[model samples]
Target: MSDAARRTVLGAIRHHLREARSAGDELPAVREAGRGPPPRIGEREDLVREFATRLGAVGGVAWRVAGIDGAADCVASIAAELGATRIALSDAPLVRALRGRLPASATLVEVADRDAIASCELGITSAQAAIAETGTLVLDAGMERHRLASLLPRVHVALVPVELLVADLDAAFAAYATREVPAAITLVTGPSRTADIELTLVVGVHGPQALHVVLIDGA
Candidate 1:
């Protein structure tokens, strides 16, 4: 671009800023802070229900359970639905309960070889938090095992406590503001899908074919 064109663009931007300031539209604090309040999504909607609706719209499944016991029941039902006789498992307490409820023939592989995990029909782990606004589950992969189990299987099942549900992404991050940063963090809003080619939606293109979240009441 020519020098004259660059100056014209700068002049237009400065003029706009001046007009905005004069109209009292300039929020210096928020601008300096580099962030502001997120858009309100749960103002009139029930958060839990909203989360489920959003999740379903994205081709993911969600179930709200009474508590941990209900979660175990839901896990069993999901296992039957998927015809999964073997599953990769995590060590979280919520995950453990699901493991215990599996049938005698169903095996839970806690310490798995990569090939075994990839071959399993499903994988189960617990979410660090669930965002109601976008139906996203936040996973802190501080323990390396959870990362592999959540990703290697054909289906990824997440058990999240009701108390861990937050109204928005900001609230979710605020809950862990004081915690030490993990080696990795994953935010999953739905099942792995892509529509990049000819706008044809394909599930399980890069990750699990299915993503299920069972929300339990007890935290």
Candidate 2:
């Protein structure tokens, strides 16, 4: 509130930054030491199973399809079931592949059109990476315009290549650390949900009511 208080806060931040720089290469090691042992989730199929299980537990649906065509078919089936006429799609290559495969009744809306995306019944996007331990889908803004598409629709569909699946949050962060960090990284585990003080749970209060994850096995 006061100028003196602001100066004190800034001074503390500067001192912390100086100490952090002094740690140099040892900083990563220190940070790692503070975290306990990572979870022992198994490899390949096991990871997929775990991800699906966790996602379902949180009110999300998961499907493992054979290829891109299978993914398209799955999307079409969902669109038919929901009677979705307008679908918001991201600009990602994988997501674009489903353009012609959707049902004739459904129309594709580009993610760039914010107004259309807001009114769409379904949103389709590609996941940069997925965490098996928590069943989280990582959407990178640097990769495409996926934020609004994933958030503004009644149902959200994410196409994730099998290769991008990671064992845990640690592995996901490690993968991100290899490159320049994106401006925004969204970790979505399930549909939006909230509860009142009496603990009466409600879904789709702020975002999509349903989340569907289609993991392409050999894409």
Candidate 3:
């Protein structure tokens, strides 16, 4: 077509698109079905266990630890039992403490390189908080640094400080909004699972196949 004709056609198309977009009806009102149940708060230890249990119910496992040494021991045992020799770790102080404790045979990963993650057997990191009601683990990505490292591996381990546990999603959201921009925030509920095809349950299809939560009592 001639240049002037093409311009006229494009202009008409753009106008039509704008009109169609503006013609959409308003969305329906959203209302809570009922007043929600009272929010439940737990002691740090209990919150950790609750998070662990929730993950476990969805096929993930969790462990509670007393301190640094305990965290190392926990990782070592899991690596040994699961025959995992490679692990990815966030560049955080508490996780760095695990350096001395990891088995020499176990290789440590610090960055979030995709190949490095795929080669590794496990990924380990820390989180910003744990939401009990939704069984979610929150990660302030920039704050945590290696957020991708935690999500991109086959097996993932987290060293959760007890004080980071919150009652529910709302509280978690409030905490996040008031805090500094975390770079990236991830709310991981369980091992990645999907039933997209023929209603078949598949685990690790979208993300890590296994999630191991290490809720440290006093880190």
Best by TM-score: 2
- Residue 143 alpha-carbon offset, candidate 3, angstroms: 0.8
Against the reference, the lDDT scores of all candidates come to 0.83, 0.91, 0.80
Q: Report the CA-based lDDT of candidate 1 relative to the real structure.
A: 0.83
Comparing candidate 1 with candidate 3, which one achieves the higher lDDT? 1
In order of appearance, the predictions have TM-scores of 0.78, 0.85, 0.78
lDDT of 1 by residue, 25-97 (tens): 9555545546567635454238888889889999999998888778888888888888888899987867877
Q: Could you give the candidate ranking by TM-score, starting with the highest?
A: 2, 1, 3
Once fitted onto the true fold, the runs of candidate 3 whose alpha carbons sit more than 4 angstroms away are: 1-41
What CA root-mean-square deviation does each model show from the true structure? 6.8, 5.0, 5.9
What shift in Å separates residue 140 of candidate 2 from its native position after superposition?
A: 1.1
Error of 2 at 107 (Å): 1.9
Q: Write the per-residue lDDT of candidate 2 for residues 102-217, one digit (tens) a residue.
A: 98888889748789899899999999998999999999899888999999999999999999888998887777657878999999999999997589888888899999999998
Q: How close is candidate 1 to the true structure, as a TM-score?
A: 0.78
Name the lDDT value of residue 70 in candidate 3.
87
Clashes of 1: 0
Best by lDDT: 2
lDDT of candidate 3 over 1-219, digit per residue (tens): 699999999999979877876899454556866435545666766776677778788887777788887888998888787787787888888888888677788888777677887788888888888887667889887676766777777888888887888988877877645677755788898899999999999998868898888888778
Off by over 4 Å in 1: 1-34, 38-45
